[model samples]
Target: MKNEIIPYILANYPDLQTTKELLIHCHKLGIKYVELGIPFSDPSADGPVIQNAATKACINFNFDNLLAILLDLKKQNINLEITIMTYANPLYIYGISNFYTNFSSANVKGLLVPDIPFEERKVLTRKNHSIKNVWMISDNLPSASLKKIVSNSNFYLYLVAYLGTTGKNIQQSDSLKSTIAQVKKIKDIPVAIGFGIKDKNDVTNILNIADGAIIGTSLIIELDKSLNSAKEFLNNIIL
Candidate 1:
């Protein structure tokens, strides 16, 4: 009940300064958790809205400087649970040896690398206990695979709601309700459903079945309209 929705935001959207302001605004609005998407060359997992945002963000995606921004917010006491979502290549290129150290210095709370699967996650998570490792799953993972991922997650697990990339307006599938319930039965972490929840009603229904909704593309599209429109959009769905 406590975790209602987790908004997935593109870092450096519109540009870096506005993105920082939007993050602070969301925290003030009582949104506790945020996923800061690090733009990669191939954001094939996402749709056009997010892909375009990634293209824009890639211009200014300086890893250390971005962490510095987070560090700056920490000094200002504007604390929001921040997670870096990216592919494995970026982290490896960032130097796995120093990746956790840098992320820790910035007070990053979690990692949601979509390309890494559960069995292989320990290689990263084992190095850093400070950041929570979030596992991703869809409705159709093998039962053994699902249980293994769900078992290791005591913090959060990402449940991909449908089969498509992000930004598509796919409705919740008939199988998702049971999938979420089964995961809840097997593990205790909050399950955040994502990838195609497009409206307030969709959010409400996601909350009804899962602990949280990991909303990304719609929020990106809304913020493009105006920061205020984005705020209003949150107002429409968050209560």
Candidate 2:
């Protein structure tokens, strides 16, 4: 099977028009999944790269406008599986029900709230909502906790490659492989490694053990430079 290459982009970064262009470029590149990050005052889980982006995005960020952009894209028949990533506070501020309703209308495929622990996910998950909750796990999680998270996960498990935040180099070790094996043994799930994948070789190497690679910081850096640079970077990695 072809491995999944999921790009994470900050919503309204630089501006909404650039965000729209990036999504179109992603779809043209045949990328099936794109993580749309909702800008928050404090993105604790991300590194300097994403933090800076979020800071810039929050200057003119409007959740409704973001949804409108997605809706417009859908109207034009440019459909990409969008997973909204944000902290728990933003969702609470938006009103949980309203958040789901808006995203559902925009045809979003999943939600990834890193700050919400597995135990607290019930607040965001509802049977009525079609958006799947994407869980993030790390190598350090206890076996029992890991099992519980994986078993309850809907779309796929996001395996954080390192212990730190995003935008770091991933050193593939036996422990990482062992963690993947443990998850596979518990249940059959597609595991995607995030938190430091930089290039095509990183994606290729990750696919050997996991089902997908989530590229964020490096891609964002290229995107910060220019849209065409971003497109070239994504093309090189996914090819």
Instruction: Output the number of the lDDT-best candidate.
Output: 2
How close is every model to the real structure, measured as TM-score? Answer: 0.93, 0.96
lDDT of each: 0.81, 0.88
Lowest lDDT sum, 10 consecutive residues, model 1, at 121-130
All-Cα superposition RMSD per candidate: 1.7, 1.3
Deviating ranges (above 4 Å) for candidate 1:
none
Instruction: In model 2, state the lDDT of residue 171.
Output: 88
| TM-score, predicted candidate 2 vs. hidden true structure | 0.96
Q: Model 2's lDDT to the true fold?
A: 0.88
The Cα error of candidate 2 at residue 181, in Å, is 1.6
Error of 1 at 213 (Å): 0.7
The prediction achieving the highest TM-score against the true structure is: 2
Task: List clash counts for every candidate, in order.
Answer: 0, 0
Per-residue lDDT of 104-177 in model 1, one digit per residue for the tens?
A: 66767788888888878755755534777888899889888999888887668888988778978757667888
Model 2 residue runs over 4 Å out of place are: none
